[model samples]
Target: MRIDAAIDAFVRQLTVDRGLSEQTARAYRGDLVDLAAFAEEAGVTEAEAIDLELLRDWQWHVSDRLAKSSLARRTAAVRGFTAWLARTGAAAGDAGARLRAPKSDKHLPRVLDRSQLDVLFARLEGRAAGDDPVAIRDLAIVELLYASAIRVSELVGLELGDVDRTRLMVRVLGKGGKERVVPFGVPAARALDRYLGAGRPALLRDGIDALLLDTLFLGARGAPLTARTVYQLVASLLADLPGSGPAGPHTFRHTAATHLLDGGADLRAVQELLGHASLATTQIYTHVSAERLKAAYATAHPRA
Candidate 1:
């Protein structure tokens, strides 16, 4: 079979048999597309034509241009594709199984401090008012992010029915398409209410059911907000705020988890609220809380 044909079959297997998400399948398709392009450039069109040397050349070529994370994701895609091809008798053996990705630096996720969060929200609050629908939506987006600490994808996935205003809870469909209800404070609830009642309605056209709709903010064309757009908004907003750290939705997630711990929220409870897969993932916030406590003690205590 041709390389392209094998990739098509592999993607089908991912979608039908493996039950991978569309996002995952799309990523696999992208990786294989890049690989196929490289193969075509090298004048090898068939699956059987690829060998270990060609694979090494592709890896070496990408190593210089791509980040370790990208390389790793692509490697996983190819490995899965090759394994499926081998199992289906399209290839003699899985040639990509032994492929290894480069070592990446373990950078801890960024978390905003309490004071910094206050500053960010205050800035957003200042810009919250206006006849412009996008501003109102942008403010609510930032507020909900800090207030809820949800993934960017989850934020964009929110629907009108998912929010329970009376209970101050937002229902989210998280990883693996699992639904979980998370509650936010009155401040977040109020921001959300304003966005829904005032902001979204202004931007909605004929057929929008999204909570934030064409907005809790809108693009220039008044379309639904995207995850990349959200990231850019957060980064640009944070560019003016004082202090240094990674700034994005995940920053708020880490901040919210740490703040929850600082406020004496039980670790397990925070885990549940954040929809963490394991307690271990949630335990990282405990260290941030402990560090804060140590700093407070060191600054205030006079005893030698």
Candidate 2:
């Protein structure tokens, strides 16, 4: 089979059979496409022509240009693709079974301190105190993001029925199509109430279709809210802060998780709240909490 056709089949299987998200499938497609181009350059365009040496050469070709993390992801992508090709009999063998890449560099996720969060919310609250619908919606978005620790994708994908205002819970469809209920605080509930009662209605245009009406959050023109919009909103808020890491919506998630741990929330409970499939994935927040404690002890200790 041709490499390109084989890659398409692999990506289709990733999304359809493995239930991977579109974003994940896209990443796999991108990596495999690059590999296909590389293989073509080597006069090895056929899927069966690919071997462990070709895979290693391709990794070496891109090693200098990509960071270890991106290289790791690309390596994993190709490994999966080759494994799929072998499993489905599209290739003679798995070319990437022996492929390896350097481990990704681990950095503690950026987390906002309590004072920083207070400053952020104060500004948001000031903006929301007015009658501006966009400002109101923005407040609600930030509040819910920090309160629920949900992914921005899950947040924008939320629908009207997904939220339970009476119980302060939200149902989110997480990665791999897993559904989980997360609880928010009273502040988030109040902000959501204000948005639902006034902001959303004001933003909704007349003659809108019923599908958009079911969306939990809407754009300025009554369309469903997008992940990019949420990213910009959170980025702008985090830009003025003293931190020096990523300023996207995931920062809110990290901050929320770290704060939960700092306040004595159980590790397993937080894992469930964050919709993490594995406790190991959620343990990073414990590291963040410990780092914070170490910073405090180092700064305030009398004998240091």
Candidate 3:
């Protein structure tokens, strides 16, 4: 089969069979598309024509253009693609069986202190006490994100029925379509109640898009809230905050996780709350907690 068409089928299978998120599937597809282009240039127009050398060449081509993390992802993508091709009888062998990329450096996720969160929430609440529907929605967004520690995609994907207001929890379909329930605090519940009672209705219109109508979060035009819009809201909130890493919606996720750890929450419990597939993935917050403890010791202990 042609490389591009094979990639298309593989991506479809990733979404439908593997239960991968659309974002993850698209990323894999993009990496495979880049590989297909390089393979075509190397006269490997068909999946059967691809070889280990072509995979290596594609890695070399991207070495100067992409970061190590991106390179690693591309390598992993191609490896999976070739494995799928071979297993499905589309390729003679797994061309990327031996492909390797430099390990991506692991950096600690950025977290906000309680004081910083206090300031942010106060500001959001102050603005939400306005006549603007968007501002109120933004406040609710902040409350929900920090309270639940959900991904932006998951937050935007919330439907009206997904949240159990009386229970103070939300049911999220996380990566790989795994459904998990996450609890929020009373503050988040109050914000959501206010949004549903007044803000959402003000922004919504009669005969609004069905997605928007069912969605808990809506845009200014009453359309479904997008991940990009959530990112922008978070970026604007973090624009002036002191931070090193990205100030996107994930910052809140990191902060929520760290704060939970700081509050004596169990590691395993937090893993469930964050919907992490592996405990190892959730262990990063332990490092953040240790670092915080060391910093607190350094600040309070005057001994040299």
RMSD of each: 3.2, 1.1, 1.1
Order of models, best lDDT first: 2, 3, 1
* Per-residue alpha-carbon lDDT of candidate 3 for residues 174-233, written as tens digits (9 for 90 to 100): 988889999999999999999999999998988875755788898888888899999999
lDDT of 2 by residue, 117-140 (tens): 999999999999999999999999
Question: Least accurate stretch of 10 residues (summed lDDT) in model 3?
Answer: 205-214
Candidate 1 or 2, higher lDDT?
Answer: 2
Global lDDT of model 3: 0.91
Q: What is the lDDT of residue 167 in candidate 2?
A: 93
User: What is the C-alpha local distance difference test score of candidate 1?
Assistant: 0.80
Q: What does the lDDT read for residue 25 in candidate 1?
A: 83
Q: Which has the higher lDDT value, candidate number 1 or candidate number 3?
A: 3
TM-score of each: 0.85, 0.97, 0.97
Model 1 misplacement above 4 A:
17-19, 206-221, 243-245, 286-304
Instruction: State the lDDT at 223 in candidate 1.
Output: 74
lDDT, candidate 2, equals 0.93
Angstrom error at residue 302, model 2: 0.7
Local distance difference test scores for all models: 0.80, 0.93, 0.91
